[model samples]
Target: MPTTPISPPPIDRTGRWLASLTQWVLAHKRLVAVAWLVLTLAGFYGSAKVTGALDENFTMPNSASTVTNERIVSRFDSGGGTPPLVAVVTLPPGTTASAPAVRADLRALEQDLARAVPGARIASFGSTSEPAYVSDDGRTTFAVLHPPSSVVGDNGPSGSEIDEETVARAAQAAADARVGGAEVRLTGNALLTSEAAGESGPAFLSETLLAGVGALIVLVFVFASALALVPLLMAIVSIPVTLLAVWGLTALTEVNIVVVFLVSLIGLGVAIDYALLVVMRWREERERGLSNEQAIVHAAGTAGRAVLFSGTTVAIGLLAALVLPVPFLRSMGIGGLLIPLASVAVALTLLPVVLATVGPFADARRLRRTDRAERHWAAWARLVIRHRIAATLAGAALLVALCVAAQGILLGSPEARSLGGTGAPKAALQQLERSGIGAAPLAPVEVLTPADRAADTAARLAAVDGVRAASAPEGAWRADGQAVVEVLTRSDTNSQAGRATIGALRDAAATLPATTIGGSTAQTIDFVDAVYGSFPLMLALISIVTFVLLARAFRSIVLPAKAIAMNLLSVFATWGVMTLVWQHGVGTELLFGVGPDGAVQAWAPVIVFAFIYGLSMDYEVFILARMREEYDRTGSTDEAVVRGMAGTGRLVTSAALIVFLAFASMATAGDRDLQVLATGLAAGVLLDALVVRSLLVPATVSWLGRWNWWMPERGRRLLRLPAVTPATES
Candidate 1:
């Protein structure tokens, strides 16, 4: 019989398209590189100016608290929206707050503060002469200064109108003028935040530099060549381009201040990650004896495609935030969505061009052998496959335990003690606590009422179960046919009892007409309800969309389901770790010099969930895509699992470490919310790479065998993907 040569399989549409695009990039290497350089320069400028545009507005539209706040701010110039800056004055031991000279000094101090801070409304022992303004011992009196409200469209008040430094200086000078020695200290949400952030918190640039250094170290260990620097360069280019996009976004809508940190840090990690995947795969192809151009195309057809899928999943995860009613979070989603897409663009377009020109030259000066890393990973994969059931069970058990710990997570503001500051703000708060005033003054409930019924409403609110006292102060509290009643709770509003007190007050106010509650605690409660109430729907939408995308990428129904399940477990595990470390104060004191906060900041969990779910999916896509390739090439599921792990295990591990280091750098921030977010993301990356991807995924794939590659006809038709035939059937 004459020899009949077998033909190679035809290239799929996606692979063919990637190969052509890679060729085109290689042809115009210089032009692509120059384009990215121009965008990067613009990005540097955008990043610098973007911060000024960010606003921390947490208002929920159409919510009861939001409606009440708008009306109050409109009617009374100072009552509802802005948190008051409290100035505490303690007279000498012999001089009571009621002393003639002391009252005169307090009145003078209030007038000075009003003069110093334009649009400020002051209420104190001098302004109202209410007994509630004085401490039990009658030596301490505090004045509440409500800063001016300037609501700019839907973004709420543009922060505090009065400057903290100005308030402090004026109050101090007036108190010093008193005949009896008197001391003044300022304490409030704004002042405490500034004090806690004093010089220790890292800026976006410094944090990016720190993360870059950490990533450099990991890259050197992995590549052991001048090529280790290539990914960093790609990141340098990717970050600024993403920021430029964000800058453009700012022109259209409001972007959250937090987006700056996320773009710098998360953008750095993701850009470098995509570059690392493509570069490593190209190097592997070259080592296998492909020509330079051939290697680039092959890498693009495989690893480049994986990067596309990964970036899309990340974008999808962040897009889930758009479902939220809160404007800032939705803006965060839009900002975060730009990050991965920009990175993918750089990796796919700019990266291949750079590699085609200088890759071989840069990779030649190797400090260590590359094969050693692969051999170690291969050996580990074999061991895992040998005990597949045990590996699966162990990984599941560990993740389950972490999920249990997450059950204790409470979503609210941190307690007063948890606020970071060792300066004047801390001392003032402590002094107020010692004076038997406690945090009640810090979080008073403001009720907007009909002017005629003000006193009656105050009396009715005072009898509420958790009400400590209620006062309808005269001057600033009454305006425009409406009166403001300030109600003090027995406990701090962030506390459980305080939350209960707010609920009781709301219920009691429900029976009263044209009466509504508006204050910090009420606003916070509305925020929590608005964000979390829709969370289940958001989760379902993300899950469904992600499942469909993964199914099309993997061409396997079972595999996508498994990947989604694993990613969810990874997210919950990360949350559990955050709960223990931050909420329960496990190692928090030793690490951050702060004690247990008893609750995670209300915004941290949702942001963490969005980032982790998508980032974790990246690993799943990387590993399984390679496994699918190996399965198609070979005729055994065992061989596919082993080969897949051996190929992608090291790459996934290195990428995870790079990302974790980037997020970990955020812990240096003085803000507790950022620290919590950083902890959750860093922990999630490690847990996913080490546990979920390493052991559980390979073990489960191996155990599932032929079934792992099966896709139903209906799914194939819906996805417009070819039916997957298992190696065993072939």
Candidate 2:
């Protein structure tokens, strides 16, 4: 019997277009380089100006909590979703709040505080005589100042624009002047969030530089030559250009502050990854005896096409966030969408030019070791293929275990202990905790009701389970036929019990005419419901679209199905890691110096799913695209597995390490949410590259044999592709 001859691989319009574009870029390398240099400079300038434009607000439009908050702000001119700043006053020793002189002093201090913080509605034992405002010892009295929500400037209505330091200072000054021998400190949700924001992790610039250094080290090790610098150069151009786009986006709509860190770190990782792919392919072409220009074009045609597909997949994952109702999440989606697009642009245009010009000089200084990585990876791939059943079983078992672990993830606000901060806010929080007055005052449920029904509402709420106290203040809390009844729960609102309490309160209030619950806690619940209520839709959209995209890119139904399944496993495993580390406190204290938050941040999972799904799929594309190409060239499944792993194993792992370093640097952020987010990203990338790409993908492909290349004629027509003949069929 005679062996059949292998046919040439099919080239699609995208590959041909990329080839032409690469030729164009090569002909105008100097112009392309100068244009990127100018864009980088503009991006640096834009990054500086963009911070002021970023919004920190989290808003859910048209929800009950939102409408009630708007009503409260409009009518009472205070207390509309923003947490009230608490002024904790410790009187001179042995002076009870009931004493005439102490009462007089308290009343005087209240008046002074009202004057000190303009547009602040003051509620205290002195003003309401509610008794709940005083500690059991009676020596500590507290005041709640509901600041005007309208004070928030054009930055968007999350109340982040309020000058927290100035407010704290003015309140302290009032306490010192009016209440002799008394100490007062300020703490609130707003103050704590502000302090956390003020606390620096590694500086953004330092973190970026650190990530760059780490990436360079990995690149150096991978290439063992000066060619390593090409990827870094691409990253340098990509990050700034993305930032510049973000700044322009800010002018059109609100961009979240978190996008800055994302653009810096994720942009660095993605840009470098794209460049690494193109450069590696170019070098491989050169090693095959192609001219420098031919290498650039061939690399562009192959790896360039993969980069485009990978970037589109990333953008598609982020696009799911746009369907969410929350404003900040939508902004995040928009900002994150820019990262991959900018990276793709740089990789396709500027990267080819850099390789054509600087690449030869860089590649001239060759490493002593040649083909060692490929040989090692080829050996590993053979071993995996030889034991395909065992490899498949082990990988599946690990992923299933992680998926089981993820079922326990709790979604809510971070625990109080995890909101680490220093100075006056910390001191005040400590003081309040010590005084036996729990955090109820910080997250009280504000009931908006008719003035005539205010007292009735408070009385009914007080009798409900989990209710610690309820007070309907007469003076400042009432305006325009609306009365505010503040209800305190026995548990902190950030806790599970507190969330249940809030649900109960809403249930109880549902029967009352013209009554609704609104506060920071209520808004948090609304936010969770809004973002997650539509989560299934977002997940479906991402899944279907990604499957279709991958099916087209890989030109096979089985391959795309396997890719999606592996990507999901990678993501869920990442979530499981987060739950164990952050929620269960398995290694949180040892690693991050924080206790279990008892829950992951409410917004983290969705963002993680969106990002990790796409990012991990990058490795899938890198590996399988090569496998497909190899299969086309050799018409042998076993050869495809070995050669594909040999081609991409080092590149995939190196790219993953660079991305991991970027996220690891982000984990140093003071905010717990950022820490969790970064941990998820890093874990997901590492897991996908090392396990999914290395072992599971090869084993499964080898097990599937020639079925990996099967594409139905109808599917090929849908993608506008040539009909496929299985590699095994010749």
Candidate 3:
């Protein structure tokens, strides 16, 4: 009789490589530890040098806004090279701003403000020849100011001291308070922008601290010993290294200030997450009576591989954002990608060495309370598997409901009225609107034409349906062979009606030779075009590439496809929640200290998608990889699902909380965009962990049974993955 041939052992190249790395780390633990410390020191030095290079200004090359910006720098004489800022003083109730007494007081106030701020050029009511400076009602009058140095020059911070926007509004407010007859308000694009950007420094520090504290509490609860400190140590080593890499990138191109916060906060959470997974696996191995070296090697072979794949998934998602033309989004992509790369480096190399040498001491003090809830994950897994259809249906229904809300999302840029602050900038804008001389002129749909046609262009723009006023102001310069006509709109620059006005102006100006429209409205239009222009392509590429990678990673077609679908659903749901709470004011007043103004920031949806897609996949990879491994060993899909959930549930929940708290910290920034970013991320993490991974994933896996792990021979060959003989259901 012919003997049954035994199949050769399945290829395990990744596991073997990881095991070798772990052994090497164990052999040179001391040297590895020292090297990481030295690298960390260098990272700190690089981070300090980078702080001065961070910039908030974003330039979209070749876009209408960029061309407009160039034109302004070359032609505008009023506000130095900077955009004009308006300071208005509303006369008490019935008094007119043009009255002799009111005019005299305004002139004195302007003089006082000029003195208070060095290099200020203020055109007070009595000094300026421009009719726009005073409202027709005479109830409101304003002054235009610009920094003397900023005019005719463009520069960013480059030295030990970072450059800051001049706070002329503060000085003007003080002067108004001192003079006391009229109500003084400073509202302009410059001042309002400064208020929003000014909070980054303090916000960064606060978010970082809060996230760290929250993570620390969770880590302590999870490990219940000195072992809790290891993840933090990894984070301490990871952040500076990531920042240094970003600083190096800045040498080649511009990097946004927001990237620094992302590196500090998100990087910290990701670093700890990688470390926690590895350490927990190592502890499990040790509990099975393995030697320290053996445990480290085993943990590296299993959990380290998961961390590597997970980091790669996240990095791929972030780097995909580079496909967008927007510089700010690109910077965030590159910088966000660096976080995982640097964190993975620490987790794979330095973490193993640390654990090999110091882990036992920390593990000695295990949890004394012996909480039974920690062991309940296995039971939860059994219950879910027993009622898989119910769990799957309920989860799908909830996710679908949430996604329906995304249908109502309205995208637009933020406006002062909706920024939710009591600062001088907000007050000033309010006063300007109340006085019927709001900053509409400051955000006109600029029409650039041949100098000869400037008059004709202005006349045409003025005739547009939404045009409030249009002028080819006298004395405007034309160094670039173009004349500028400012077309003011009746609606706010970021409003729907305002955007419609921009379209109408463009249509009206289309007949004019050499005409181009540029201004706030133009910028908004360009931004939307750039984002959506390639968004569908970007989304397809990311999805296809992610699916291919996951297929190779888990060696299953159905699982990877399901994972992609589930992740996309999670993203849509998160966007819906964001739209409801932020754009629609569902909880704006109670949660964010401001009311919704009918639109979400234009960039928010794309930014959140890039982040949440990758992050949601993180939990998917973590949980499903374990189940895959268990299934391979047991040849029973049901057993694998239950065992995987029992082994990974606590780790997944804690990791999710760590990241959620980190994002939630962004709410402390007090900016609408930041809050939206925070909300999307926090909500995505919670939903993915508790509902998607915990309920949907297991239920679906159980329902699919053996098909969950099936891979055809042709497909396995195509992907160059190991082949496995089919096993019958247990």
Candidate 4:
């Protein structure tokens, strides 16, 4: 049969090498199963005692920030100057946002809060903070509540505290506060982020589990074996054990649960995901009458190499996150690094051993009726093949349009209303707001300059364009030899205006030769800066590694380029959708829960993009591999592209579905901000899986024709990549 060039698989693929290795590993699946069972028992039992929903953003670099938060926490430990928060208060009709009744009500509300909250020694609130109340326009007013903390060293409760009664009061007060005219709204970090995390966290769990199971089910169905679940189970072992390890390690180091979760999910998903590919390929080798050990050796050599490339590509891509200055990025990088490393370990060690032990499980689902989805995917492939160029161009065009939209997206600071799930802390914020002291929404931008430079920096800031009202002097803070400067935001403090103030202050301080800004807002600006600057490095990492891996995998440079292009395209499209829904506020009001007034959080885009890029690459690899397999067999690029599309489409779609479901589940939580984020992710995943991968990727690959695989022939030798080898197993 004359073979033609295949663009790449329209379907997602784990590649031939992965399939073969999985087959070889299945030989000793029983031993792998037993080992996993024991490990699960030991790990789960150990962590069971402390198992519960933690309110803190699992990603915070608690080590560094904890000290600062603790200091602030300790000051009011006995409760003195700090005010009682009253949120969810009613305001009189026809009164402006800053009207007297609203202002008086704020004071009354603060007093009411002091009287209502039983545990405090002292509390205060009034109309003075009113400018910040109702958000300057007076639509939202909140009195500050300084919850009295336990005396120093007394452990004044973990933020919202796990106690039931306290939680109940917080809730009841919020609900009852909407009396006399105002509808109360409660929000605060403790409540907001907790709720946000609650919504997104479980969805993540569900996505991981479902993806793992879905992959397993596919394997069993493909092999007509009931035991296909074993290998997948082997992969699941990595997630929980890894998470606990991540938790304990984070207590000592800087990693967080998000890192742990992502790594574990990727490790489990990709590991098991790749493991299946390796196993399937190895099985083909076995069916060819190769001896068990030879098949294992062949699988390892061939599928193993592909697994190595895929894992290495993914690991390298994610590790780029480390270059970022923030803890979240570092956590992502380190976690990403760990997952693949772990995956490699299992694939080479436990996987190989298990496959040898439980090859019988491979046949368990062989006789089951073929899953309908696979057939549907096959039909899709034929249609794509029949109209390759037009299909491809159409797909490419769509992705490009989406990509453009994604680029236009914006972000804002997350607010209490945005935080949907974490309830108790939110109640506190609400209580504070209802009290009518403004600044509830203010993320204080604290600045400290050398005492010598303080006045000048303060003066420059005082005179700077956006200074709503610079305090008589820089407010007092405890930075040594540094005068603290607090600049009330003038509209754009959280927008370009806010960024500009930060820049001007920074620039002015730089000119002073001794001034600097350091506070939550300042830190946020810095963090955003760090993330923005490092994003290129992250993209470069993915691109370079992808280029290398693709070239090697296909023995051609062009294939990798096409794959990466598609992956990026998926990201762009996802972003465009997010920008429209989350940013422009044209139609996003209802989905995210809070009023669409707040801008998107500045940090969400980088983080979200990071996730989108990495996961899309996962799909790209799967598709490319399938196409590669077909190309290798028939030597026809076009035919191979179609066949590969048919082969891997169902799996990729299912994988996307699981991921989508995981993210969307977050929307159900209490925090509105998180709900929006979850919605964005869910939408992105759906588009990526069904639209980009299924339709666009296939069509584009078809249209690109041979050019999709067109690499500069002479350039391949320049990278000095390892000599590619066909799998020994099959």
Candidate 5:
């Protein structure tokens, strides 16, 4: 037999560290196991605090609206950040509000509402005696409910508005109005935000359970033994630990309520994935005939190294959120970042100990077995390697087509029409609008100035484009020698036209000293600018940091670069799918029980991007790291690609499916933003695993051949990596 070429020792510091960690974990298996259990118990104890601290309100600090609200709070002790809830009171056809019978009914209705929700200060035609509160047609009028600022706590004024129970009750109280042959209905920023957030808690719970069940099933298929339970156990432990860490974070800063859903759903997927990668590697090492201890060490050196780098990539992708300048988004980033880091910690330490103690029992039963080479994946990989250019071009063409479809996406806050037509609020708003009384500005723009300038400022604003009306009623709102003028727009304040109008008014107000514009519309402009203004920098930071870390892991220059490039393509493709489904309304109505809005929700894109970038890398690292390992042993690019696929193909697909299920469950919340987010993540995982990771990546690597592993001698030395000659065609 020909002598085998001697393989060089691993010079990678990361790998050595991982190997050392595995040894320590294995040596103290019992102690590590007990410590993890205690940590998990602590997490359960802290989860309630995290839950209580979450707030859904979106705020842009130092924005026009924020400054205006602060001034109102400090001076008038009112009009902080409360969006007015509109109670549409419409008389029966042929009836008018002036009718004595109608007036009596209106008064009773007002009393009923006050009795129903005592805390929100109720302002209506019955309570205020203001002609403007009623429609010019005399058949319709409205009441405005102001949510108390104190209930919002220290997070901010907007926080009170998103309290699902509070808003739902307000809407219900309005819907229950039945006096004076008139029907009462509620539709406003407060109600709309409530409807979206109301279902999040139950939906998140459902998604977590669904994902858990799905993961167990997938693990069974992959392992075909009790060993499938190993990852699940790790997930149970890791999820709680991550939650506990997030809870501690909340004590020091504002955390978004949305982060709870993200941590639970996304965290579940990531935890199991880390465990799966480690378990699969351990199994492979065992099959190679190494002792249990030696196998754990070798698996840790290879798969553990990948998990460490992959976790960093996942965390780095989420770090982009910290650049957005919104505390809620930043909290989401922090919450998301914790999942991978916590999972990595568990995987490197607790996981090996479990493998050393409980893993053998689970692995003992093997109803289905893996061979030295997984025949199906090997054949498919060989097929792609042989026809590499065609595979690469086909995948690229599909991605390009998807990107083109995404180009027409519209982005804005949801319109009344987009909130769906089934709710009581929807029915009321629609009825009022048909009679030419559109949903009035529930969140009116506030123009603040000296008391003397109030009338002049109001008159000037009334003349501006898109202003339906402006008023500075005497004694209406005054404090600290300052006056407040309310300006109503022709469009719903959160709509695109409304935001455009707000921008123009801001430009006009520049000439007026000490006059500030504040409302939902003005805040939308600031929120978008603050987040997107810094996105390019965030993208660069994530990509650069990830590339360096991945390069160190693979010990090659080309692999990490190619991996990053492919991930961007996948992300764009995902956005295309989101745009098509949500913005374009391709299949939303029939599938999700909601009609397509013309625009995606304001905050969905950045959150989705941050999560998708990291999640996509999770699968990318798992597959490519295995390929890198194979290439070092075989020194043949084609063989390495084929064998790596054979080894990791099922595991990657299973992991992707698990994550997809987790995100897909979010659609069940019956909220448009949740649906869009679910669609983006679910579609991204499918395309990434099936198209990018499965086809494009392998084909690209095969076409590049030995060049895929190339590094200059100087570069190799700088990174302190082992020497390797590039392999030529056999």
Candidate 6:
């Protein structure tokens, strides 16, 4: 078909730049396509040769937990006592608490556990050691098993001691318990860890596979052409290569699987997502007036730059997690930095080549859908613009309210045995209460005094407000010249009082003895310290990076600031939901079946912040790219906001759904931690898609009016920032 020639057409700078860019792309199609194919194959082959880097705690080197594991290892090497485990002896509910059968059964369990797991010594007894470790009632009994260092390394404790192949021989000495006709149960750090791993594994595999297939289906439904899926098909091949490369690097370095897998997920997800975004726009460009070559270049230069800007901001934000002064977080930061770069490279190279070869088939139907002006998205944008003030206020208020609830969150405690009333820890705790020690929660405090003043230090520690008892064992291997004090409290250890208890113990021991606390309680305190302290720094880094990058992308300082603020607000809102559902016991029974005891997961806040910040910026690019494009033509912020939000809303929602589905599937894993994480992430992304991107953003943009285009003088002079190409107003 012959195209109409332009005569005295509009002389717009943005359009002229796009036209020049298209001419440049058309001139080099063959070379670019060939190079893209070569790179894609190479990336795939490399990943295939590399292994899958998983967070296999048992196999993971000591580097994952350097600080904590190093101390435990040194202590064990010095002949310090081993870590303790819990063994539960169950009896019928109606049975007498002090029955002879119960006592005999408890003794038999001790022997059986020792035989089953060799070197498993009894750390404490319910009757003789203390009552706090067990329950006050007599129906439950606890045998704390402390395995010797010979079998399990302190750095990475062995979860599978008796292998399946050797279990028969090991089981020969194991006592088949029938205590008072109730089945005996044993569960603690070891058992729970084992179960959580098993659950996360299969679910991770299944969800990954299902998500890949679902993403493909969404592409097909959206584009309605197999050729449209070519970009994604390249991604499908590239992800494995990326994953293997990550794994291979890990064997030689400290790079953990979290970086590899998460990056792969986001990389493939975003690469495919970006590919879809550009391909459709390419089709639209062709349909408008340009040849295939001109159209592909226009898509790449415009949408390409948008994706590039978005990817960098996200990468930097995630990378900042490493700056938290923590190791695990550092690894995650590295992973964040690498994966997005890989995704961007693929989108730039692979997608362009695929489009070069199959651009014609993309819009083969040549049938444009009608009623676009009255589409769901256009109506939504109008509603938001009409109610900009009200909608923006509501959104802001919602985030503030949720953040207020989060202020009440307490540190989590995994030490006590009386959580939900169905385990060994509780039984042992109940026994301790009966013995007059378990009534109140306490933080354990161990103090090492100079030999000359050991007795004097112990006497001083005993007088601390929360110190229930202080034992200064002379010449004991557990504490060499140390006074190990048991500090009891009137409040739970996870509470404010409990945190105060730990600080108090340290202060009391500072002058008397050099002290340390090593227990489940100690681990909780350490976690709280690392997470809370790092949160502010994390927020600052993310806010700065996002603001700088987005500002550079649009040459608009105010717009970028808005984007970062909106992103943080989304994360805050998610945190609020978590606090209500997890910390405040609002949805505990319905969601997890157990009433929440203290705070959400120790790492939840950080994880939410990282994911939300990275993903929210995705929409920022989609909307802003179109806004920038429209600004070039109309020079009207309100027009750009409506046009941009409407034009890309469908694609944005599809991308959000892909991420949401992938995360939500984790809820099926059944582990409490996994379930909570999946919920928080999915909720955040969902809100970003509907509430933030769809409603809040356009409303705010409408209110900002002309100021939305304001940019720092420095950005304007660089010219590296792409000039906005404004199309004629619809």
Best by TM-score: 1
Candidate 4 lDDT, tens digit per residue, 371-399? 46556787888787787677667767776
TM-score of each: 0.92, 0.91, 0.87, 0.71, 0.88, 0.80
Error of 6 at 477 (Å): 5.7
Q: Can you give the lDDT of residue 437 in candidate 3?
A: 62
- lDDT for predicted candidate 5 compared with the true structure: 0.76
Measured by lDDT, the strongest candidate is 2
Report the C-alpha lDDT of model 6 over 424-539, residue by residue, as the tens digit. 43443454445544423323333434556655665676677765544443322233333333334444455556656656766666564344444334455565676678788878
TM-score, model 1 to reference: 0.92
lDDT of 2 by residue, 332-399 (tens): 89999899999999999999877866889998987766589999999999999999999999988888
Each prediction's whole-model lDDT (CA): 0.81, 0.82, 0.75, 0.55, 0.76, 0.59
Per-residue lDDT of model 1, residues 1-730, tens digit only: 2112222123456766777777777777778888888898998898787778776665667889878877878876665656677778677787788887778877887887777666666778876777667788988778777766642222222223235565466446444544246667777766565555422587768888999999999999989999999999999988888888988888899888788899899998899989999999999989999777788888888888899989999999999999999888898999999999999999899989888789999998899798887888788888888999999999999999999999988777766666666666677678777887777676678898888998899889989997877878887678888888888887887777888899999998988988989887787788788899999999999999998988888888899899989999999998899889878899887877777777777777888999999898888989998888888888678888888888888899999999999998988865666777888889999999999999999999988988898888888899998655546733
- Candidate 2 regions exceeding 4 Å error are 1-13, 89-102, 134-141, 150-162, 170-185, 190-198, 421-437
Q: What is the C-alpha RMSD of each candidate to the true structure, in Å?
A: 4.1, 4.5, 5.4, 8.0, 4.5, 5.8
Residue 148, model 4: lDDT of: 50
Q: After superposing candidate 5 on the true structure, give the runs of residues whose Cα lies further than 4 Å from its correct spot.
A: 1-11, 53-57, 73-80, 89-143, 151-184, 192-206, 371-373, 421-424, 669-673
- Model 5, range 370-420, lDDT digits (tens) per residue? 663388899999999999999999999999899887776556555656665
Clashes of each: 0, 0, 2, 101, 0, 19
Candidate 3 pairs with clashing backbones: 80-151, 81-151
Over the stretch 1-730, how does candidate 3's per-residue lDDT look in tens digits?
2212222223267766877776777677778889988989989998888868866765456786557645654564323114445667666667776667666776676676666555554555554333445667776777655444342222211101112435554444544552228666665555554454323434577778889999999999988899999999999999998888988999888888888878888887799989998998888878888777777777888888888888888898888889999887888898899999888889999998888668999889887642354468878888999999999999999999989999877776555466544576677777777767655644556666788777788778878887666656444334456666666677776677788888888777777787878765576677788887989888888888888888888889999999999999999999888888877789878876576756777777887898888888888888888898888888899999988988889999999999998998877876555777888888988989999999999999999999998888898999998767776669
